[model samples]
Target: MELIKLGERTFCADGPFKVGVYILKEADGYSEVCIIDTGVDEAAAREIDEALVKAGFRVSLILNTHYHADHSGGNRYFIEKYGCKAYSQKINAAMISNYDICPSVVWGGNPVKEVLNNYFYAPPCEAYDISELEMPEGLSIIEIPGHCIEMFAVKTADEVYFLGDGVVSVDTLKGHKLIYVYDIDKQLESLELMKGLKGKVFVPYHGGITEDISKLAEANISVMKENIELILDICTTPKCLDDIISEVFDRYGYKLTMYKYAVEGGVIRAYVTYLYNKGELVAVKEDNYIRWKKA
Candidate 1:
């Protein structure tokens, strides 16, 4: 991957998932870099390391947006290799230190062996709570929790905001129809927050860099509303959680795998919870099954 310069000190290693590289200082004749988020795996981290080394930079710190494998999978690699410090929100730091929590939470219990791969379980690494750490000069954290618990967007001194999946590209929405979210209400609030953020450029991990994020934020908000409506429509006749998930998969043409069942299924459940809490949907227990129906 190539590091594309965004500002005087900000650069993004553009790949399937963008990794933010910010030059903190030049020390010992090498540029000291603070990585916003490491990519999916060791391989991704290795590529980033090579790119940074080629450019005469050394990683001194990693600021994880959240504990998702795709975002923090390379944490151990960087910390072990460079002796770099890693930090995240308290809850995320705990998860990053013990990554099995990820797949277990997604599966709602002890995860089966099939779901224990890198995508679900990141290699564990020690990470301190960002709140307790002294942030490097020019780096600031913005709380944008929703996509994941305690996710934060980093704003560089150059006014470049590294949005950690707070908003997805329109194409990502079109491809997946529904993105994974921990809390629907928080996700919507974060979308509104993204619109009001002032930045020279905003970089979403999934979405490419853009000067303005209004359209992208609106698109994400629209898809979330649409997904909610779709769920409400499906529940009109009353359906069990499994039935709703099956119908959603059919409507979205999602290929069912163990992984998608956990991830996408979780997204549907979040929408269901949002609607139920809003009093638009009601839960009924009948014939040994709990079903949801339009209220």
Candidate 2:
């Protein structure tokens, strides 16, 4: 992983997943580093540690945007090795400390063995409530919820924004037709919020950094609307949730897997709730099955 400097003190480890690193100089002639998000596992954390060590920095704090495994998976490593202070929103902090809650929530119950891998369950790590953390000078947190519950975007004094899955790149949108969204309505609101943000550089977790994020935000909004419309069309004929999931996955050429069924299935359920609340779709319970149809 290459550590690319964004500002005087802001740097990012650019790799499969961008990890934000900010340096704060202490009075005792020591430089303490803050990590924005840990990557998928211990290996990713090791790479980050090596990169930061070679750059003459040591991790002292970790701020997880949310409790997804890919973002919080390395929390255990950092906390164990460096004794780093970790923080996230209250619920996310709880889930981070109890990693199994992640897969259980995604699966809507106790997840099976197939869904309990590193992708869903990170090694457990303790985290405090973000609200309780004392803010360092020039570091601020922005609440950007949509992709996940209580997700945050970190802004440095240098005006660099580390957007935590707020908006995805056009290439990512094209590659993965369906992006996971916890709340479709809130996701749209967060995208609108991002357009008005002033930043020297914006770093999205899954995409490259850019000076301007307006176009990227618009691209994500467009894809979200398209998914909403597609789901509505699929409901033109009354269909059960399973049918909708199958049709949506097949249309996007996604192979059926237990993992996708849990993750992507949750995304579909979010759409269903969004459309139902908007009065665009109606649910009918018949013969012990609930089916949805266009209103």
Candidate 3:
């Protein structure tokens, strides 16, 4: 992982999955070094620790934007090393502290041994509920849920916003074709909210930092709308969930692995829920099979 200094107060540890961990430099030395998100495991945390040391800052606190392994996997390492306080949104704090709940929720049932691996679940760590605390100085926690249950964006006084999977990069959208969202309705609303953000720079977890993210936000919304329409078209014949998933994947020619299957299932289910709630689709029982059809 390469740590690129973004500003006097901001630094990014660039890796396969980038994380924003900012430091507050003081005249005497460094006052507090705050971690926005940890990478997948201790390995990522090691790099972050190195970056902190190089910047002459003592680790003060670690904040998780959500409970996903890629975002909070280094919680144990940071907490054990610095004895720092960890904080996250209420729902995410509860899940990260437990750990098992993440994979369980992802698989929609008790996860098998394969799904319990570090890729799906990280080591448990304690986190304070951020909703209970007053907003920290020089930082504003913006709720940007939907990609995960309680994902948030952190805006620093430096005018850089650490967007936690709130708005995906254009390249990610083009390559993956479909992004994950637990709540499609909220995800769409979050995308719209992101459009009005005013900041000097935006740092996406998986994308490069940029001054403007409006184009990327628009691209993400376009993909969601396209996929919803595709699913709606396929549901004209009262298809089952698996059928809708298959049709969409086949149309996009996306090969699936066990992990991808689980992730995509949640994404498809979100679209289904949105359509059902909007009265654009309805669930039907035919021949003991549950299917969805146009309302």
Candidate 4:
């Protein structure tokens, strides 16, 4: 993946997920750089290294926005190659260090061999909890969780916010109707939070860089509400969770593979939980079957 220059010191590498890598130029010729949200594998890490070498920058540190494989998969390569300290929030740091917790959480159980591959699980790498680590001068960490557990956004001194997966491109929304999310309620709240953010440019991992992200955040919230309405409409009668997911999957015309099933099923469950919490839906066990129905 080629690196696209975002600013005087910032660059974005396109990959399965757009990776954000920043180079902070020191007074000396030796530049200090930070790799944010490594791509899905070792090759992605290599690409980032190559880009840095070509630009005459040295790695000083690495940061992970969350524990997702696509965001943290290349942590092993960077840590081993440059011996740079990796930092992440407490929960994500634990998941990254453990590694297996990622696939297990995503699959909601023991993941199959295929799901255990690099696409979902990465090798363990040592990382420090962000709270314990010293925030480098001029950089601030923003807590923006919703897409994943305790996902943090890196706001550079240049006013460019390296938003992890808090927001995605519109094309992505069209193609993948259900963006993988953990808490729809928090997701909505975070979107509102992003709307009020003061930044010159915002860069989402799966989207392009823009001066304003309010519209993008709004689109994400709208799509989430649409999905919620779909589930609510289908729950006129008590419907099992599996049935709800199947119906939503069919409506979106998305393929039902193991990975898709796990990810999409999780999103569907989040929708149900959001509605249930809002008192718009009720969960009951009828005939030994756990189902959700409209309140």
lDDT of each: 0.89, 0.89, 0.82, 0.83
Candidate 2 regions exceeding 4 Å error are: 26-30
**lDDT tens readout by residue for model 4, 15-129:** 6566776766574766788878877788888887787777677777888998887888888888888888888999999988899888887777887665787756888877889
Cα lDDT over the full model 4: 0.83
Report the poorest 10 consecutive residues by lDDT, candidate 2: 23-32
On residues 145-199, what C-alpha lDDT tens digit does candidate 1 reach at each position? Answer: 9988789999999999999889888778888876889899999999999998988
CA error at residue 10 for candidate 4, angstroms:
2.2
- Greater-lDDT candidate between 1 and 3: 1
lDDT of candidate 1 at residue 180, scale 0 to 100: 80
Model 3's alpha-carbon lDDT is: 0.82
Put down candidate 3 lDDT per residue, 1-295, tens digits, no spaces: 5677776677777876667767644536655778788888999888877776776767777778888888888888988988888899998899888998888887788875667767558878788899776766777888998888788999888888889888878877877877878898888899899887898888998876788778778888999999989999999989999888888888988987677778787689889989999999999998999899988
Q: TM-score for each prediction?
A: 0.97, 0.96, 0.95, 0.95
Clashes of each: 0, 0, 0, 0
Query: Which runs of model 4 end up more than 4 angstroms from their true locations?
Result: 25-28
User: Which clashing pairs does model 3 show?
Assistant: none
285 Cα displacement, candidate 4 (Å) = 1.5
